[model samples]
Target: MPVKIRAATQHMAMFSVDADAAQAMIDYSGLRVCRYRPNRAVAVLMLMRYIDGDLGEYLEYGTNIMVNPPGSNESGMRALQSAGAFIHHLPVDQAFTLEAGRSIWGYPKVMADFTVTDGHHFGFDVTIDGQFAVGIDFRPGLPVPSRFTSKPQVHPTYSHLDGVTRETAGEMTLSGVRYRLGGATVRLGQHAYAAELASLGFPKRAMISSSADNVEMTFGDAKEIA
Candidate 1:
């Protein structure tokens, strides 16, 4: 259906999780957590502000689990290298985008409110279902080489909702990108979903955090994962 994001300011962070607890959080059929070790898994969090896009202006927050690609035996570094993600929770502020995300890609998108502070250092405060969820802040670390910046990379993502699982190869290109080791700070609040995220060892520093000022993305058809 042709989804494109023309300009955005986004922040992302990665965290390590106990694989068993992570797996219990997902509990989706046909999906396996990619263990970084015997019991460690990777969890990812992102906050994005889409200034221009086919879906219109909206804010989004996501928590995803690193997973083995469907039907693959890859594990550890191999699976990490595979770069496959399974969406656990996605919240957006726009109704149209919310419906579009779910109807088109089976994304489990829920309506939420966001308070954003934009700049070199970015902040996002998200409230879900009328309760405060999380407050996330990011600080830049070092410059990513120009060669690596503004390049398109297609990311494989899986989503299971309403008894349907779908895979999408979402591509993004970015500029003004900066990242740092342990660059993220998070605060948990009254929402139950916030507690759900806390299960993965939150209220702690992120292993890595990054921010980009201008970004572009594209999403095409979603393939059913058998």
Candidate 2:
């Protein structure tokens, strides 16, 4: 199969977690977490609006634990550097993408109701299985050099299955990008899955940012983690 491409606008944030707690999430993912210290790891919360893709328009909510590439000690850099995300939870607004994501990449995606509103800032509300899961409010910050203008990025990600795990690699490009660091408000509700995210310290906002416009991504095939 060929790489699946999507045009999107995304809101992302990074935060510090109790390294032990973050490690627990990584361990649960069946992939090892690279420690910044003896007990510290990083968590990323992403909300995406897919304007065009194989499945057309949809919304995706990803809660991820950023880890090192399998056995590599690349932790000397930043967490997002690896892009080897251990997806803690991924919720989307459509079944087509849900089926495609799972069948193509082994992504643990499910259907949900999503309201992603973007303007002066970006915000989203997501509900899964008829329960409120998460809500986030983000403010745009400043412009940094565009990565989409530079070389494309190939990110390797890991997902767990029955007694085994898989690896999915993706390449991404973006344009007309303006980066900013600002404030975020995250609400973790009473849903069971929502609680699972809370366990990873979702409420604490360490870093928040937004892209003003022009972003695209191509997600490639998923392979076995060897």
Compose the digit string of candidate 1's lDDT tens values, residues 1-226.
6688888877899988888888888877468899978898999999888999999998999989999888776677766988588998899999999999999999999999899887767788989878989888888678787688877888899999889889999898988888889988988989987888788778887889987878999889899978
Residue 18's lDDT in candidate 2? 70
- The global C-alpha lDDT for each of the candidates, from Candidate 1 onward, is 0.86, 0.73
RMSD of 2: 2.3
Q: lDDT tens digits, residues 1-226, model 2? A: 5655557776777776776777776575557676665566777788878887777788888888777777766554464465478887788988888888787677889899987776786788898878888888887667667654547767777776554578877777766555555467788877777787788776776565556354567666778775
